[model samples]
Target: MITTSRIRVWDPLVRIFHWSLVAGVAANLFLTEEGGTTHQWIGYGIAGFIGMRIVWGFIGPWSVRWKSFWPTPSRLKQALRPNYTAASSDNITHTTLGAVMMLTLLALLIGLAVTGYMMEETTRFWGVDWVEEIHEVMANALLLLVPLHVIGAIVESIKKHDNLIGSMVHGYRRVQIPPQHMTKHVDDRA
Candidate 1:
């Protein structure tokens, strides 16, 4: 058995935002026809989710805050250290690379949303080639990045010996620490 702490890192809002965003992206990317009302509504919903997440980062729990996992140069260095562990991070919702990817994904989503709105709602950008091009590029970029994000989650799960996907789903994570680091006795025989 592993001595671990069951931490409520993801929280309900975070998990809901995560999975709902995933579904909305999938629906917009595949299920719904582009330029159709359904697709446009989905895009608007995704934009809303992103907006809520950004606000949550400011007022939500410490674990989900920007400062917690912003991947600053110093924090990245610490995460990149050879002896780093999940315990090394004050926030487990993202690794250093995960933080970078999160920011990239958010920017891309915002780009998609803005370009989408421009194409749909504004005369200046409506029917404009460049605006449509940017929207397509952003959607394609999201398609590319989403898979890599999944792979990263799998890799992190293996590396940490924890179920990161489960954490996202259940809003809880079992953060295992080495026996020596524990203040109590453990039976980590395996």
Candidate 2:
């Protein structure tokens, strides 16, 4: 229940990207009506934001780095069980499920954007029923996954003793940082 204010943990760019994607995905989920130009635009925006995220994952803060998403079998097992131990401050980032969701949503959003673009073009993929169907399926999956994402955030906030949503907005967390392993300057210096 501690709420100590701290320096920025989520960089401003990361915060903006996070919220933009959230808004875009939420809009994309509900605006699928025929001739919904706004919805299509939002999907494109989400795709762009996701692209930014992929780049950011490569070059963003220590917390949001692509290495953070690197799949570790041990971490995946820990995430699957209830006895998962929180990593040090340096290791504090998406867990296995979080990484999977990030990848899934990225693929789905990109698929939607590419299909939408192709669907509009006169050549190739245009008027292709299967492409349109895949787009719809991915959109529906996004709608289903978003609520689960929210629930996961809530549960993680409670377990980790930090407000996950608030951290994104204000860019900070109050979790205890483990030593030894966190002191490696290899990644930080690169």
Candidate 3:
């Protein structure tokens, strides 16, 4: 392994949002009764987190901002290249594909929150089949993608010899930066 240095990547708020999202998803999927009060409250909490994340994407430090990892079509292509690495001087945060996954997860969370609220709080859609179907589909989709997200994180962490999981918990990763790629870090973790 190349020599690595500690640098902050995820911020504290980002870390909190991440683990909270995981817990909410897990609780609703495995612990709570469907449409139960606890489930609904967790869903509301998740929606609030997503809303804050979206706002933070605008105002957070450069590494956590949307512009830092906005996976445009062309950008996706670049990210897919065999040699693509997050250690790039220009983009040192989430892998581009990870950004895609993050956006998909957030979108699904929003769908669940809205549909769940409609079913629980509104009379017009209380018995609607389509809304409930949409909600279930999104939740199941999360079941599939959440595992993939975890697997990807594990794979990258091992391949890069960096603790991707721990980075989220504590907001730092030990990364090897080639001399040619050295640049001022964008994150303001301190």
Candidate 4:
């Protein structure tokens, strides 16, 4: 049996934003070829989700803040060190590569949504060649990036000997060292 500390690391809004964005991406990718009202709605949904994520990065929990995810050169080096492979269980948040993945996904999503909207506007002409080209480019690029993201998650999970997928679902993970060990370490600094 595994026990996890009840630290509310991921706010409910962040989880909702994550899964909703996943669904929106899937829907937009598979359904857009048919070109219907549903596709347009999904595009709008993706845009809304991305917009909320930008806002949440500013106002969300400290763990999910932009500063937390934005890797400085030094932090990136630290993250690349072998120590990350044996990360103490309490530090299960996104790593440097994970941060880059998030930013890439955000940019791709926004690009997809913008091009999709512009491609549909009559005044802008639904048949604008550049808009269609960029949409196709961004879509294919994102599809390639998705596999990389999955591989990174799998790699991190394997290195840390933890069920990363399960953690995302349950919003908790058990550490080998007790939470008290971490809390004590923090207290020593204060």
For all candidates, the clash counts are: 0, 1, 0, 0
Give the least accurate 10-residue stretch of model 2, judged by summed lDDT.
181-190
Of the two candidates 1 and 4, the one with more favorable TM-score, higher being better, is 1
Tell me how far the alpha carbon of residue 117 in candidate 2 is from the true structure, in angstroms, after superposition. 1.4
Greater-lDDT candidate between 3 and 4: 3
lDDT of 2 by residue, 1-190 (tens): 3223333457888899888987777666655654278876787777788888888888887778877656578767766777655432234567678778777777877888888887765478777898789878977888888788889888878877778889899776655543433433223321
| Per-model TM against the reference | 0.86, 0.80, 0.88, 0.80
Of 2 and 3, the candidate ahead on TM-score is 3
TM-score of 4: 0.80
Candidate 3 local lDDT, 73-137, one digit each (tens): 98898888888775452455778888899899999999999999999999999989999999999
What would the TM-score be for candidate 3 when compared with the true structure? 0.88
Show model 4 residue runs off by greater than 4 Å. 1-6, 32-34, 80-91, 176-190
Taking all chains together, the TM-score of candidate 2 against the true structure is 0.80
Error of 3 at 30 (Å): 1.0
lDDT by residue for model 4 (1-190), tens: 3334433346677778888887888887885653577887888888998888888889887766888668779767877787664355245467777887878888988988888788775666588888889888988998999889888878877876666666666555444545444542122211
TM-score ranking of the models: 3, 1, 2, 4
Lowest lDDT block of 10, candidate 4: 181-190
- The CA-based lDDT of model 1 is what? 0.84
Stretches of model 3 off by over 4 angstroms after superposition? 1-3, 82-90, 178-190
